[model samples]
Target: MKKTIIISLLSAAMMTSCFTTGDPRDGGIFWSPSKADARIGQLNQTNNEAMHQKQKAENRNKRLKAEKVRELNTY
Candidate 1:
């Protein structure tokens, strides 16, 4: 009814922002390797899903590949 619609509009208006992340009070997110050694931060805080996933997958693959190559060489 009209009352329900008015309440819904007021609720939407009260909201501050749509997006939120990484609560500081909960111990700042510990991103390892720092941005210096990792050479990645812009992409880390980006709003793109595919880019983030691809970067993460690539990093894992690279580490595994390096580990395998090292093991083979040591054998």
Candidate 2:
């Protein structure tokens, strides 16, 4: 019985060690530094893309508002 308990504890520890703690994108305990760095780079790229899209939207809105103002001034 004692041996079975020890085996169970060891198995649980090994399984938990493989589990990632923070972001799901993060590599768990077994992953190398380069893999984690790559994940971080991907996240940064995604964020930059989102910011670019936001800026485009804002510029479009500003252009539309300027057109509306110009139309009103003509009338």
Candidate 3:
């Protein structure tokens, strides 16, 4: 009797879960941007932009320094 009752309860639970899956909202997790996700994305964009700008400035400075040295050596 205990086994039969336990089996029936489990079957009923499984059936409910299966039926609920038919609903669109409950079927799967949509990858909508939450506030945290948006904030994280924004932070990532800002950091990447900053790094790019820093690298460009460093390259420009290096080129300028090299040109100055070349001019001095040629004089």
User: Residue by residue across 1-75, what tens digits does model 3's lDDT show?
Assistant: 999999999988776654322224445333334644666788799999999999999999999999999999999
TM of each candidate vs. truth: 0.37, 0.60, 0.55
Give the residue spans of candidate 3 off by over 4 A.
1-33
Q: Report model 3's TM-score to 2 decimal places.
A: 0.55
Which is the better candidate, 1 or 2, if ranked by TM-score? 2
Q: Could you tell me the lDDT of residue 73 within candidate 3?
A: 100
lDDT of each: 0.65, 0.81, 0.74
**lDDT for model 1:** 0.65
Q: Please say which candidate is ahead in lDDT: 1 or 3.
A: 3
**Which of candidates 2 and 3 reaches a greater lDDT?**
2
- Deviation of model 3 at 36, angstroms: 0.7
Full ranking by lDDT: 2, 3, 1
Superposition TM-score, candidate 2 onto the true structure = 0.60
Q: Give me the candidate number with maximum lDDT.
A: 2
Tens-place lDDT per residue, model 1, 1-75, is 999999999878665434333433434334334533343455456647778899999999999999999999998
RMSD value for candidate 3? 8.8
lDDT of 2 by residue, 1-75 (tens): 999999999998888778543344555655456666777888899999999999999999999999999999999
Candidate 2 stretches with Cα past 4 Å from truth are 1-31
Among the numbered candidates, top TM-score falls to 2
